[model samples]
Target: MYAVYLFSITWAIVQSLPQGAPPSVCQTLMPFHGGGIRPQGGLSPYTIVPRRQGNHIVVTMTSALGIPFQGFLLQGRTPDRDIIGQFDSSSVNEGHPLDCGTPSDSITHNSPNDKNSIDVVWSPPRGYEGPVIFNATIAQEYETFWVGLESDPVHVTKRGANDPQFSFPLHNNGPTPPNYIPRQVKQNSAEFDPFYQGCSVTKLCFGSPANCVESKNCKAAVAVTVAGDKYDFELKAESSAVWVGVGLSEDDKMGDDSVVECVKRGNGIAAFMSYTNGNPNYGAPRLPNPQLGIQLLNSSIQDGAIYCRVRRDALTIVNGKAFDLIGKKYNLLIAAGSSLKQSSVGFHDLTYLASAQSQALADVSALAAKSKLLIRLHGCFMIAAWLGTASVGILLARYYRQTWMGRQILGKDVWFAWHRIFMLLTWALTIAAFVLIFVELKAWSGERNPHAILGTITTILCFIQPIGAYFRPHPGTAKRPIFNWLHWSIGNAAHILAIVTLFFAVKLTKAELPDFVDWILVAYVVLHVISHLILSLMNCIADRSSERRVTSFPMKDLGGPGRNSAYSDRSSDAPYSNFRRGLLAVYIVIILAIVIALIVITALAPIAESWTSFKSAVAPTNAN
Candidate 1:
């Protein structure tokens, strides 16, 4: 009986609590469900319910995370007109409806306001009856919230009218044309124009920021807005430099262009300069005349992003020449460098915008088409130069110099002559390939990459080899040993470097080549290695046989008394007579096969289509 009495008392207390009791004033008064919440990363989910309280529509926004929101922007559109406003944090209340519809530039409203819910009231435009779509953009430090009405509309009964009423749509849908587009907001202001949206491009430099490999902060974003005859540019970058500039160019070349640069120094010291480029091929770039009608509105650095807003007239007049921006498309060049000691020549990196409408688009397309042809030609020339000419020259010098065929058909001096001619041909082809790359790239900036470095080293070594050969010492002289050592060392070094360069070239062009090309190259290398090993073994056997024959008979007897000259010649020649010829023939066949395979692969590879992926990888667009 005592336990039953205790249970009854506890149940009565629980029933009398707030959950079972009467609802709060706000809940009872504004009981309509707005919609579900669409959550975003680093942001608290929220639901907004619009209550028809008297003449105004009170919007109650409740956050699921129960964290204070820093800012709220509501953009709604009716059938006839658009409404854009923010919630007034000071007028937030639980019981009574708060007044709304105040225009302010500041987005932070009592930040960290420590309120889980806030109320905003919107006065509908006079005489609009269709469903209203509300798109809300709310934000905090690390989080952003987007809430709006979807295509489906929610209905609500009018407070006193006999007709049925409905609140604004609650789903945040994709981008659509709004009834009203906001004008350009003031520079450095928290307010942003929702209309006249533009595109943005991000470029990452080859060199890391501050030269640290792990630091990827060396990047920039170029956002452009076209408004009438005015072009507004906002450049945000992760840089420590005092100035950044954007240039408009007819081609990828930098000098023949107009530059609008922003200069910012320590302690907020700033200046804007406009310059026309002189000859870049000559001395430093000259800005003869400062541009007119270009204004730097605002510049700031926040959260590692350096923001600069600059506006200029679409038509730029410089030295009696006018450049129009509206109809004509120009390449966008962006550069950032230190402003210490007031130097503009030391740019950290340079990049151009690559898009269909960009000025550099032509260059990109041309490069794609031209590079394919150049790569094939270059590969063929390099293979002939390095593997064909050099290998044949070295082999003739090493094995065939003393052979019967070398002495008879080629004569005593013919081996050296042919070797020299082949090497000279190699030098010519190497120089041609080098020049072709320079012409294709149109610049000598990427000298630090592995491909460029190896090619440069190999070219230098190739140049030195023929010069050394010209000064080679006479045979049987004491200095001949030293000369031969130096010659062999340098020649081997050049050959090895050439092979390494070819390997890297294959790797660099792998994306552009088919899978079979790689296998073909590997087969060539393997065959070359096997042929070399066989030649070395044959050389060792010939040397041993010659030494054994010389030791078996006394030198005087072999030349003088009982030595049959014919027998001596036959014994000396039998060991390596036909073997060297057979091996050389096999080596020639292998080389021809490799060359044919390379040609076939190059012909079959889709070099032109590969550029599409390359362009997409390098050029990316970020839109909000």
Candidate 2:
């Protein structure tokens, strides 16, 4: 009988809990399956009291007339019933915090024990300055509950137009624009909120993950709102990043753009405007412009995230380019890095994104990263051009020159025919890869990395090789020797340069390849050198053996013309066919293996992530 009583209490406890979970819905705070029952309509024994604490509002849900309620669901909201701020998670235990859209958006009771009051630390929503109130639902028993209990109204601090700090002079300050006023002055840090509050609806907001802002879970985001001649930009980096910035560019590329950034130094956060001179290596990347038209509104550093609000001119000139935020459509560049030295920041190795299309600076949308198809194609084609086709072509022309003497391919010596085929394949792939990259960038890449310049030179050399081969003198001509020397020099130099360019490609920020890719390239180079050395040794041995055979076995017997011809051939030549073919097979296999490896790496440039996803797809089979 005691056990049955215990089971009944356990069942009641479960039945008395609110619906869904901790973050109770704004409309339905009552327990699920209680719709059939009517709530108490008389004066609720509960009342809510709200107290102000700086920028936050602390709400108290307690007995109005000394009546203790067993359970309650509490939330703060604006006038239109939209859930406003999140309750602090640490302040609630029995009634856990809920994640409606933002973290701790709602809090409700999970236990059934009676209590006089539940004090939930409710704070106002970030960036929201409208009036707010706390409404709570209290339940005395499983079947008895009260709804529509309300608290006194509270108003958040607003930035009025008459505020002197926000007023700006209409005329330009000569070459200098307005300076940034630090929010560190106001000493008002609570105004710092998620930058995505007014995203897309009232501002031009963009960031990574595309949906981060809409989902209320942005890692790095920017929202720009038009306010007369001035624009309000709220930026957020949901990480311990040293800096985060947004820039206006004519194209998707990073250089020649105008950047406004917030750097976190020591304990304070500040915003600044700078220009990147287009070439990463040619000039300083972060050239601070104290005269730029930028103003700091508010900023904060909490939980390692960097949030700042700033105002910028709608029309200004940066890097000699007329930056009319309201008139011109522009591609946006958002970047952040881990290190900062004064005004200069380290490479945007953490998060670098370019918008998919150009938009008027005042337009509203999330940041969609430009498609990387062209970039991927460019890398793959280059790998095939240099690593696979070019290497094989060079090998054939080097070692197989004398090996395929008897075999004819397309009316030419087999070695010469195959060599031409591979070389032309290399030429075609290289040219296509070159063209594709230009098409992707729409201009000559002004990146600071050497890969661009090195690849271009390699392409030029590869292009001249085929043209030079086509115009070569006949084999017996005096100039034939010169042609062969030039051809060898150019081909070898181009091949070496191409290999080195591939090495530099691994270091490119846009490449997104891991450092281990350098080791892969190193292995390819080592294997290629070893293969060449083996072939050279074999060629020398074959020559020595041929010489000894010819000297030892002399044609002493006089014979007729046909027989004499055959004997002469045997005496002059090395044994033609079998061993060289076997050697070629081994060489080709090794080359193909390396080529396939590089191609795989290029096609899946971000290889580790791809591998993880692949493993996840096949994990069930392995488990089984």
Candidate 3:
């Protein structure tokens, strides 16, 4: 009896992990340690490298710094954090599929043996064309392990719709059906203007500037036409854009929306349908099963534009939810951009116009563009806060405190008084701008945009500043120096963060600001730094000159009223006082100019429309 009990205990210990990590650890990637030992911290002693080879990716995991590991689990993952793509059986070594419910989705070591490296090949299913990453978990032994180590991204471009690798048949499957329309429509063709032929009459034409289809000058547009049980879609965008897409959304936002995109790769165009679930970073944009709903008619890249024609099922399922487009109303969101952010489309910096309101998808009439009033107001307020008021407040607190020592207004020192007012204005403007953005989005922004996170942090820091100042320690107290340092540190941090946040805001699609806005931010940084350097030099010169001056007579103050007059007011007669005043005036002028320029740019975004208006107005005068 005693021998059988001991054998059972030893067998339980061996069963824990002698073969490999169990299927239960597939997602968590943790070793089952009944002893409560946790995985080691910091970076793992293992490394994974993924190299893309045509339609496949070769993933290799090796020990770092000659630290051979004993066990590991591997999987191919998407930006959605989904475990996808089956590992090749012929290429795998010392590992086999764990069958983590999703067959072949994960691989694990066969035995607990110290190994140098394992190389495996993975093939993604057809139409999962976005990006893929290799995720790995490695263990030196049972206790010393690392979980969730990831490899660099590998982007996958979809094959052309006509290619043999595509979802549709390589050749024409059968004779053209009676209801079939023309397959290809050359862009800007002189033979026929097919896409815009029925604009606002037979088809629902949607694009920017509200009259682009009629005027025959649209950078990106979508024309939707409803047939018996299918919807024909024509998407057009400037060839400069790598991809263009149209989404059917109940609202202006991208959450839970069905997005159909035409991607330009090599010389041909490929079509895709994705589900964007609001998380621009981790959403399942490549939800797959696209062939069940969309049939590509033809696509082309010609005459400075890219175009694709498709027929979609009137009732289709995306991400397991049925979306019916026959009689339902949806706001058409048409966007085009030059790049893709992994699975998610890149910022539609080129075009991001939405229909004014939800309307029938079958409406064969004009669709008004959504007003960007709130977006413009948010941008303008942010500029007015950080660029205008914040700049004034920081400069005053740093440089003018010495110059305006003797001047007082409203029982407060002149410099401090003005600084307080400017800072308070900044605080108020920041809060208002913060509120406006929340009102616009109506929810927390996704993690993909660093601007949203940094902007929130900047606002929080700004809010805490006034509260800190109100409860600050009095002068010369034990904690006064500490309070001063903390105050200065927080103020500088908030100012720096605000400027950085503004730079990121240029990339936000909703802002609609032009790329030149980045140059504007750079110009401000350069000018701001130069001004600081100049003021610092001036202050150093003043301090050095004052210290080096040898007092010929220490009692001169008793001898003359002129002694007090010469040095009494730094604002009036000390050192290069007039030169400092001139610098301050110049600084204010340039600062306000840049701030106002940015505000104007935000007010009339895209900047191109305003330029077109200016040119149109001038052309008539020139003709006269």
Give the number of the best model, judged by lDDT: 3
Among these predicted structures, which one has the highest TM-score? 3
Q: Per-residue lDDT of 1-624 in model 2, one digit per residue for the tens?
A: 423533543454456564423433455554432212334444556667777554456677776466777777776767776666778867766577777667777777767777887777776654566676666767776546666566666666545432211111242212111111111234222222334444565467777534444545445677776655676677777575888888888888777777888888677677888876664352225554643798876566766888777778988787667888867888877777777765576667566678888987655555567887888888988888888888887887776655555678889867779889989999998999899898887766644588999999999999999899899876546676677678888999999999999999987766767789888889889888987887766666765766632221112111122322322442222454466678678767877887788778877756765665566568789999
- lDDT values for all models: 0.49, 0.67, 0.72
lDDT-wise, the better of 1 and 2 is: 2
For model 1, residues 498-607, the per-residue Cα lDDT tens digits are: 87777666544221354456666677678777876776677667658766432212122223333333234532343585787788788878787777666555544443
Cα lDDT tens digits, model 3, 442-525, are: 778753469988899999999999999999876645666667777888888999999999998888766667889899898888
lDDT: which is higher, 1 or 3? 3
Off by more than 4 A, model 2? 1-242, 253-256, 276-329, 337-351, 360-366, 442-444, 548-577, 609-624
Colliding residue pairs in candidate 1:
148-170, 148-171, 149-169, 149-170, 149-171, 150-171, 331-359
Q: How does each model score on TM-score? A: 0.45, 0.58, 0.62
Q: For candidate 1, which ten residues in a row score worst on lDDT?
A: 27-36
